[model samples]
Target: MGASSSIPTDPNQRVQVIAAGYGRTGTVSTALALERLLKGPVLHGGSQLLVRDDKYCKLWLDAYKAKDAGDKKKTLKLVKEATAGFVATADVPPVDFIPELMELYPEAKVVLVRRDPEKWWKSVVALTSKATPWWLDVAMAPIPGWRYIPAFMRRFSKSFLGLAGVSDDKASPAELIERGGPFLLVAHNRRVRSVVPKRQLLEMELREGWKPLCQFLGVRVPKDPFPRANDAKAVDEHAARIFTRVLQVWVGIFSTTAVVVYTGWWLWRNKQQSLIRAWKSLKTMDVRKAFGNVWKSIRLIDLRKSFGRVWNFFKPANIKKSLGAVPKAVWPESKKPVVEHSTGYSSIWLE
Candidate 1:
């Protein structure tokens, strides 16, 4: 079994919901729903979505230029309180907040929303992470070659989820689903059941079709299906279209720049050797593994290879290594080498 619940058991206090499921599992939508359903203040992810709103963008931009290095905390607090109009969204680096947030919001509803893992992965790569936010876009612009892609992915994926209007992006609880239909939802429900008595913990859709949800909360159901939350796929398609346009232009420019850079470097070396060797280290197992990944991306698969992932309160270090992501155990305090561009290149370019 997973270690003890990190959530408080209070049935009456402010519910703490983590919405820990992967992105695009409908976290923003749930935040929107909570803002209305909770009928009170909500403080959601702040630093992460500065680009999503003019107020936040301006605040951070000013802070970045300000001489007062200590103004960040005050500014963050102001930003949090400023958005008190609706369900507040405040997503930030997950690991950084886990310890303090859990302590700050005791009795908070810990809603770990989940969805089909494959869908989650694909949605991340396709729809959400494409923003190439200032964090990733500006920062990664200088990185060279293969070393750049990983940081580029994380900064975009974890940073501001670039979207137009804020709806589900503001307040919907985590979504739970299985490939078969609500698998993660069922599993999450089961996990919660293992700890809290079923009565206190309700598992109803945050929509009108689900009668019990409002009943459980002592609110009357609306005449409509919980306001037809507009988290529809069309929103994704629209934003994706804009991103696709910018991408084409940027890709062309970058490709040209790269060709020029490598060609000149090759001539300067006076030898025909490559800087990095060929990509021949690819393993047969990796090729075989990619077939499943391809199938999963197309929604053609729903099989589970293991349940061992559930046994730890925290996902184990060994599993992370197996997954090939930068493991949390060693992720922080690591730095990539910086390449110093020579003055010769500038002089050559000017000439």
Candidate 2:
């Protein structure tokens, strides 16, 4: 079944369904079913971030970080930010935050999609084996415009592998899943059961078909068969589509930025060359002569000022001395005279 046209655009709109199911547990099918039943968008894995207008990959990454930090409030906020405008969320990253999401949207019905544990693990191994390799993801990371590919891989590893306690140590998917798969399945199911009330939760397997799901959601089952998604070929095709879309977006942005930067630099260089040419032309025209004339005018003005000062000093009342002679007004007057002799020398004193 196709998604409904009635999906609301409001990011803050209350969510109607929360698929608190691990990946490989018929999540894609459940998401499709929920979208058809709810008549709104159902987010599933990276597909929503890739296909939809909402770019919640970064927000999901942030939510993972918040989860690691054990900050429930921060995790809730980030989950809400990522899942906003969507009526339902199914699959890995969303499933990892089920507890916080349950608390945040208490009114939302929880669908715990289930499958035989061994079969689920087998599916997980198969899918992860086909995933982009760790080395390839790392190698492509430093390349400009390809960083998103590695980023998506890392987010997947953290949300899926890390949560399952599978080491991202370059091990084969079979080995990693063998080590972590059983425990992850048991612990995850146990946690979900412990948290969600029986009335609010519907445990389902895709093989059980649409009736159980439709009844749980109080909606009519579609005439179409239940969605059986994430087959190997379908998974590969979806991955290709996501990669193509992401690559196109990054390439377009990179091309646009390059054009803008080159245009700006070309315009600036042309303006700079024009200024240099204008300066060289002024040099050829002997603009220094004009500067020299101005300097001469300034010096003449300074010399005129010096002459005026000299004339002022020489005016009658302003003159204080003539040659080396002292002025009589400045000399001391004698009231008595005395003579002294010392070492056959005589001196006269006036007081």
lDDT of each: 0.40, 0.69
Each prediction's Cα RMSD?
A: 37.3, 13.7
- What lDDT, from 0 to 1, does candidate 1 have? 0.40
lDDT of 2 at 87: 88
Looking at model 2, which ten-residue stretch has the lowest summed lDDT?
A: 322-331
Q: lDDT per residue, candidate 1, 1-351, as tens digits?
A: 001112213323343344333235555555544545665443444223322345443443343223124554554444333332422232332311332333334434444444565655555444433444444444334323212333323432222222211222222111111112223334433544455434444444333243654565566766644433333353455446445655676688889999999999979775443332223345324887788788788675333323344544246675665465321222224444333334234322210
Give the clash count for each candidate.
Answer: 33, 0
Candidate 2 scores a C-alpha RMSD against the true structure in Å of: 13.7
List the candidate 1 regions with Cα displacement exceeding 4 Å.
Answer: 1-20, 41-99, 133-136, 139-212, 215-218, 227-351
- Candidate 2 has which clashing residue pairs, if any? none
Candidate 2 per-residue lDDT over residues 183-269, each given as its tens digit? 567668878899888999998777899999889988888998887775555677766754675567668778999999999999999
Please, what is the TM-score per model?
0.36, 0.61
Error of 2 at 293 (Å): 34
